[model samples]
Every structure is written in C-alpha cells, then in structure tokens.
Target: MKKTILVTGASSGIGRATAKLFQSKGWNVIATMRTPEKETEFTELANVLVTKLDVLDLDTIDSALAQGIDKFGKIDVVLNNAGYGLMGTFESAKRESIIRQFGVNVQGLFDVTQKTLPHFRQNKEGMFINISSVGGRMTFPLMPLYHSTKWAVEGFSESLRWEMAQIGVKVKVIEPGGVATDFGGRSLDLQHNQEFAEYNEFVNAFMKAMAQSMNPETMTKPEQIAEVIFEAATDNSDKLRYRAGADCEQLLGARDKMSDEEFFAMQKQILGL
Candidate 1:
C-alpha cells in the first residue's frame, strides 16, 4: 500500500515544499494550513489533500487528521512544521506574544503528537518529523521566545523517543539553519520598544548584523530542507536528529566542540556586540 504523510503549516515555505515533494514521490499528502481556502496550487495535485489545520486550534487539528485519514486511509508520517519566530528583545515582547510563541510552537506540537499517538500505537508503526531550528541547540541575540520554544521541542522529542519506541513510533527532529523563506518577513513577529533606550545601540547593531546574515543566495532553500525531512522519514534509522543545512552543520559542530563561554564569545563577536 502507498504511504501517506500529513504536514502542518503547508500553505508556504518548508511545509508546502515537503508536502509537494512527498506527493510527487507517490505518497498521499494531507497539506494543512490555517486558511485552506487561500491555497490554489495544492488543490490541483492528485494525491494531495489541502485542508484546514491551525496548530493553535485543537478542533482544527482533530478535524484535519480525520479528514486526512478518511481521504488517504492511514497517515504514515506527520511533519509538525507549523511555527513562527518571535524576534526582537524579550523585554519588549507583549504577554500575548510570549504566550502565543509557546502556544503555537510547543503546546501545539504536543497536542498534535498526543492526538496522533493512539492511531500510531494501534498501527504499530509511524514517524514524527518535527521542524526544530539551529537555535534549538544554540542561541542568538534577539529571539529568546522563539529559541526557548524550539529548545523545548528538542528536549521533548529527544525524551519522547524512548517511550515511543515501544510502540514502533519513531520521533525525529529536523534542525535547519537560516532558510530563504518568509520567516524573516510575514512569519516573524518582531517586538521592540523605543522606550527601552538602553538597548537601542545593541539592538541596532544586532539588526544590522542579522540583515547582512540573511542573504538569500547563501541560505538554505525550503526545498532542500524538505529533502532532508524526506530522508529522515525514510532512513529507518534510530537517529534522533537531522541538521538540514551547511550552516546548521557548521554551527552545531562549533557548539559541540566549544565550551559555553567560548560559544557565547563567538556569538558576541559575530553579532559585533
């Protein structure tokens, strides 16, 4: 029987690319997003089901999964790719933004995984490919909220694997470095307070450094990350993590070999702080 994969946040970027790639490879795809009505491209695909699934909405999550199982028989893999970055200073972040960062990235992922567990447990085989970030393992200047949630995801997935193994449910994390996506655009919630005059100089320097770093020509493509996700899904290994870009490999490598003070010093030097 042909396999099926369910992807969240499939309206754009990595999720969309992964959904399309899996469909092209003869896998049934449940391409889910907050507003399925706005999607036009995936509607034309043969084995793809574009549906509504806002990670923050439990009802939508349940409905989308049901819709996928109804249309494609069984879901063999689930790619939890629904998340965004909350940038800028954490002190300037609104209470709602802080709550929302954890809600969508951490709580939402937990809900989806918990909801899907029964099905996978009964089937005796399934896989979860979570979209983490290089920030999950390391840190940057202005994205404390975003990095915190990803770090939570990393720890949760790593620990969950042991229990999941008993039921043949595999858990894997994909850590991608800076990608050429709208994450720095519409997907990013930047919080800043001009009233915090003390942070102005540092914030300005950090933003300037970030702008220079986010070169699309040098960053990894969403399609390339999708390819990595596909490999993790089919590799059938006990590997718990997969880094999805050359930058990811480099940064993670440095973190692995360096001490905490050394890594922080390097980061400060790079950001010119």
Candidate 2:
C-alpha cells in the first residue's frame, strides 16, 4: 500500500507544495488548513482530502485526523507547518500578541504532537516533520517574540526525539534560512509602540538590513522546501535535523562555533547595523 501524509497549513507556501508533491509521488494526502473552504485546487485531486484543521482547536485536529484515517486507512507522517511569527521589540508587544504567539507557535504545536503521540506509539513507526526555521537556532534584534517561539520549537523537537526513539518514531526539523514565502506578508505580525519612539531607529535599521539580506537572489522557494520535506520522509535515517535553505547551515554554524560577541559582531557587520 502507498504511504499517507497529513500536512497542516496547506492553503499555501511549503505546506501546499508538500501536499502536491506527496500526491504526485502516489501518496494519499490529507491537506488541511484553518479555512478549507478558501481552498479550491486540492478538492479536485484524487487521493487527497482537503480538510479543516485549526491548530489552536484540538477538536479540529482530532476531526481532521479521524477523517484522514477513515479516508486513507493510515497516516505515516504528520507535518507541523501551521504557525506565524510575531515581530518587534518585546516591550512593544501587546499582551494579547504575546499570548497569541506562544499560544499558536508553542502551545499549538505541543497540542498537535501530544495528540499524535499515542497514535504513533500504537503504530510503532511514524515520523514528525516540523517546519522550524534557521531562526530557531539563532536570533536577531527586535524579534524577541518571533525568536522565542522558534527557539521553543527547536528545543521541543530536540527533547521529544529522545522519547519518540523508544517507539521507533522519528522526529525531523526543517530549518530554512530565508524563504520567499507569504510569511513576510500574511504570516507576520508587527508589534509597535508609539511610546517607544526612541527605539524606532533601531527597528528601522534592523528592518532595512533584513530586507536587503533576505532577497530572492539568496532565499529558498516553497518547492525547494517541499523537496526537503520529501527527503526527510523517505531518507530512512535516524537523523534529527534537516537544514533546508541556503543560509540555514551557514548562519546556524556561526552560532555553534563562535562566541556570542563574535557571532553578534559578524551578524552586525553583515547587516551594517
């Protein structure tokens, strides 16, 4: 029998691309999004079930899982790709924004993994391909909220791998450096504070440097990330991390090899901050 994969946040970007790629490979795809009604293309595809799954809602998660299993018999992998970044200085972040960040990126991911663990344990073989970023292993200024969530993801995946190992379940993390996705437009939240005008120059410098650095010439595409996800699913390795974008390993390597001050100096020099 062909394998099956369930992908979250499949309305666009990496998740959508992954769903398409897996289906083309003859795998049953459970392509889920918060608003499945907003999607049009996946509905017409055979062996693909476009379902509604809001990560924050456990009920939706359960429903989607049940629906997928009922339709496809069994799911071999679960790709946690539904998340958004909250950007800006921590002090500028609203109470609700801060809560929402952890709620979705951290707690939301935790809930999904927790719900899937029992199923995977029962199967004695499964995989979790988490869509984290290179930012998960590194950090930048004016992005405490965003970085915090990614850092949590990295740590969570690392620790969880040990537990999953006992049951033949595998955990893999995709760390992309700079991807030209809707993340910068729709998946980003900008936190600001008029009271903190003193920090405006810093934020402006950071944004300017970021925009100049993560251009199309250097960034990865959705298809590229999809390819990496496919490899992780079929690589058949006990490996835990898969670096996806051009700068993913390079940027993360600096953090691993250099001291905090040295890494910060290099990053500042590159950004001209």
Candidate 3:
C-alpha cells in the first residue's frame, strides 16, 4: 500500500503544491485547510482527501487526524504548514497581533503535533515536517514578529527530534527563503509604526532594494519546495533540516562561514543603508 501524508494549510502555496505532488506520487494525501469548501478542486482528485482542519482549533485538528486515519488507514507524514506572517517593527505591533502570532504559529503547531504523537508512537514510525523560514535563522529589522515565530519553530523542532529518535519518529524542517508566493501579499499584515515613518523613504528604498535582489528565476518554486518535502518525508536519515531555496542557501552559508558581526554587516549592505 502507498504511504499516507497529511498536509495542513493545504488550500495554497507550498502546502497545496506538496499535497498535489504527493498525490501524484501515489501517496494517500489528506489535504486539509481551515475550510474544505475552499478546496473543492483538491477533493476532485482521486488520491486526495479534502478535510476541514483549522490549526487554531483543537477539535478541528483532532477531527482531521481521525479522518485521515479513516480514509488512508495510516499517516506516514504530518506537514505543519499553517501559519501567517506579521510584518512590521516590534514596537509598532499591537498586543493582539503578538498574541495572534504566538497563538497560531506556536500554540496551534504544538497542539497538532501533540495530537499526532500518540498515533505515530503507536505505529513506531512517522515523520513530522515543519515549514519554517530563513528568517528563523537570521533576522531583519522590520520583520521581528514573523521572525520570532519561525525561530520558535526552529528551536522546537530541534528539541523534539532528540525525544522522537528512540521511537523511530523523524522530524525535518523545510526552511525556504523569499519565494515569490502570495505569501508576501496575503500572509503579511502590516501595523502602526511611528518611528519607522521617519524612515518611510528608507523603507521604500529598502522595498525597492528587496524587489531588485529577489531573483524570480532563482526564487524557490512551490513545486521545488514540494519536492524537498517529499524527499524529507520519505528519507530516514539523521539529517534534521533541509534548506530548500536560494535565499536559504545564502543565509545558511553565511551562518556557516561568517562571524556574527560579518553576517550582520552583509545584511546591512544588502539593505543598501
């Protein structure tokens, strides 16, 4: 029988691409989103099972797992890809924004993983793939909220891997850098910033700089990330992290080769300040 894969936030971007790729590969793909109605197209696919799963809802997470097992009999991988980005400086971000960030990105992920652990432990084999970001490893001035959540995921995954090792469970992190997805437009929500307003001209200049630096051709495609995720899900190696995009390569390389100060300087240069 083919292996089974459960993907959260499967309505779009990397999650949708990953689900389709797995279904194409003959895996039983449980493609779940906050609203199954939104994923009418995925339900039409033969190997894909569309289920309702709002990561923020504990009951929905449980229902999704139950449905996955009922449909596929086994879940070999759980891809935690449901998250949003809060784009703005820390001082400008409201308390509610911070709460929402931790609630969805950190708490929701924790709840889902906790709910899945029992099944994986009983089966004695499974994989957990957390979709993190390059910003998790390095940080920028304006994106502190987004960076904090991802950084938390990175730390959480690393620590969880050690505990899961004895049970034949595997944990893998997919860290992608600046992909030209609707993520920038849809995922990010900006907030008030009085101090940064004086820097608005600088901000616009930086935005232009960012646009110029991002290479469309080299930008990590959703399919490319899906491929990496598929490999990570299937492989049983000791490797815990897979950097899956051009920006990831640059960031990881700088982390590996340069001193902290040097890397910071390089980031400053890139911002053209």
Q: Give the number of the best model, judged by lDDT.
A: 1
Candidate 2's C-alpha runs over 4 A off are none
Could you tell me how far off, in angstroms, the CA of residue 107 lies in candidate 3 after the best superposition?
1.2
Candidate 3 residues 1-273, lDDT tens each? 899999998988899999999999989999999879866788788978898998878899999999899988999999999888887656678998899988888888899899999999999989999999888888876778888899999999999999999898999999988776767677777774756677677667766776677666767888899999988987768788899887789788988899989988998887886
TM-score of each: 0.99, 0.97, 0.94
- Deviation in Å, model 1, residue 43 alpha carbon: 0.5
**For model 2, where is the 10-residue window of minimal lDDT?**
210-219
In model 2, the Cα lDDT at residue 236 comes to 97
Q: The CA-based lDDT of model 3 is what?
A: 0.87
Error of 2 at 150 (Å): 1.2
Better of 1 and 3 by lDDT: 1
1 versus 3: better TM-score goes to: 1
Kindly list the per-residue Cα lDDT of model 2 for residues 1-273, writing each as its tens digit.
989999999998889999999999999999999999988899999899999999989999999999988998888999999988889878888898898899888888888888888888889989999988888888888878888888889999999999899999999999887888888889999887867999898888889888877677568988899999999999999888899976887898778999999999998898888
- Which model scores highest in TM-score? 1
Candidate 3: deviation at residue 66, Å?
Answer: 0.7
